[model samples]
Target: MAAWNLYRHRNSDGSSKDWAVRSNSDGSITTRRGKTADSLPGVSNRYGVKQFDIERQKQAKGYVLVGEVDIDVNGNVVFPGKTSATPTQLPEPDANPMSVPAPPVEALYWTVDCHAKQTIRVELGIEVRRLIGVIQSVSDQQSKPEQDWDGWQQFIDATLNAETFELSGQIKSVHGVLPWLFLLALKAKSFKGVEIDIATETARDLSVDLKAEQDVLVFFGTDLDSIRDTAEVLGLLKPRLNLAATMSDTDDCWF
Candidate 1:
């Protein structure tokens, strides 16, 4: 008898495929792959670290471990915690993507456009106050009541160095910081009301005029694909469509 580890990869469109791997008694590894309902054929030509490498490759391709099962000499699958030899069915696609749990925090990342350049300046007196307010609002929504204020203040005082009473930076130089500027622009809906100004002096300047509210939205919509996650974190927006997929669909028009 050989124990097999099963994995399944579900697509956003509700379709899925199943894969299984097991080590043979003779020190070789056998793997099977096919649709959930299909009788998957096994291939066993590799040995040693190849099995582990294949597992990692499948996981990288978005396959998730389902469970372990044993295959007897008679080719019957003994599912753990179940008497049935039938494989588990793939889950239905989520109609509301937001209902799916967020990716691990460590997996979250800010997307930056390496080619774009712009210098943004936010007036200290009014804009910084509003920025702080927005940060506080986000922290309050995300953090516990007892820790929100302190966390917000420490982030402002230590990480941002906003005590200088002004905020200005080159977008290209600090691409990760684009989300903060985007948040400010997103909240105020205009650069003037927030007292935030943008200068595109560099050779590789942004294609959209950041000063214009409509253009700002369009630019963020089409270019800053990952900012949707940040906006969702700030409670300014809800997760709706897959932004990356949407951008890919519109790539021809933009380029």
Candidate 2:
């Protein structure tokens, strides 16, 4: 016979929002605009299968969701709830914000399973072996040697052989070709700085291209999900590096 209390307001502009009632205590009220504790009790949440499907597509195209708004923790949302319900908790941010690697990133381990097509399975990771670059010889100039024949050959050999590789001293296996396919993987430290780009083709092929850098990492595959998952883990942006913002404006775009 407990009464419902205002736990938090869930609104973009802040009007009457959701509420949660506590069995004991005065109960808590939260504003859809207000800030929640950095550390809230963790809760198990699940996204609709359809939503996850959309996420896969968006990520495949190189988009990411890094911000959350109008969130409520420790609130009762279920209808006609009883007193046994527990408070919701927010996920913990990386302990060392700068040090914590991105969740999904290029050239990283990823396992993907498609519900609709059980036959679709993908595993992505870095290759442990490294290959030295070599040039390809052309028999006839009429055939016109590939623009990047050596580079391309090196790319193919490394990518195929990259079934095993190393990154940051971590040993990982490449399940198969990756989404955002790259001809090869190489260290790009030779360049002072570089911008990275991730792309997908009509054939469902994945490609990652790091520009103007001698050393780089490449992933070749058809699984767009794995490419995105890799980018998410490696912290590399599609053709760019995404910087985290500390503030935002009315449009919700971080500034």
Candidate 3:
């Protein structure tokens, strides 16, 4: 019945934290010292045996249980056919506290699922693509007299403004357009409910993932006049990319 006597780290005031337990090739169990984590056993005899009076012995010294694992009767720390659960052993900190590595940052991400409103999304996508094409065509056909970039840009902006101009567009619409509708409303003078419900949800989820390292501002419009951003612009936010997705499909695309 030999097993690991897990011990967690706690503050002097008895608050608990996620410090790793210490185990060795031998059946012995111990814990690291206060304030340091992922380190080797700093305090000796911290882990107490469950089968004997060892639990009382360690508790007397203020050790807390974290978890446990079964050991073999041979007393050679029989690792139960499981992958190594040992936490990574951290090296001693440098004399300069700042020299120590910063704790790993949990990646923040945001997910926008528009599967429910695929019909509207595809429609919007088609219109947006068409408008984008018109803009590009106008820009490239500078030598042509028929090109009308300004008119085309205004048309797209007006279209986007009419169909889905603000955050309420998503909330008020049949389906949730979310970031699509919400981001547009930002250009408005003043609006409400942006920070509530879906908006706050997006923030709490930390789903702001993008290929670029800098912040991205995605604008859904028809023209590129004010598109080429300044120092404030990190990158243009694009639509949700699907693998092998077509540029435009009669059934899939709206325009």
| Strongest candidate by TM-score | 1
Instruction: Please report the TM-score between candidate 2 and the true structure.
Output: 0.18
> Which pairs clash in the backbone of model 1?
none
For candidate 1, give the lDDT. Answer: 0.46
Q: What would the per-residue lDDT of candidate 1 be over residues 74-173, giving only the tens digit for each residue?
A: 4455676644465453333344556554332211111111111112222332443565676556545442322112223422442243222222333332
Model 3, runs deviating above 4 Å: 1-114, 141-255
Best by lDDT: 1
Task: Compute the lDDT of residue 112 as modeled in candidate 1.
Answer: 17
Q: Lowest-lDDT window of 10 residues in candidate 3?
A: 166-175
Better of 1 and 2 by lDDT: 1
Question: All candidates' TM-scores?
Answer: 0.32, 0.18, 0.18
In candidate 2, stretches whose alpha carbon ends up further than 4 angstroms from where it belongs are: 1-107, 117-207, 210-255
| Candidate 3 residue-wise lDDT, 147-173, digit = tens | 222323433453453332211112212
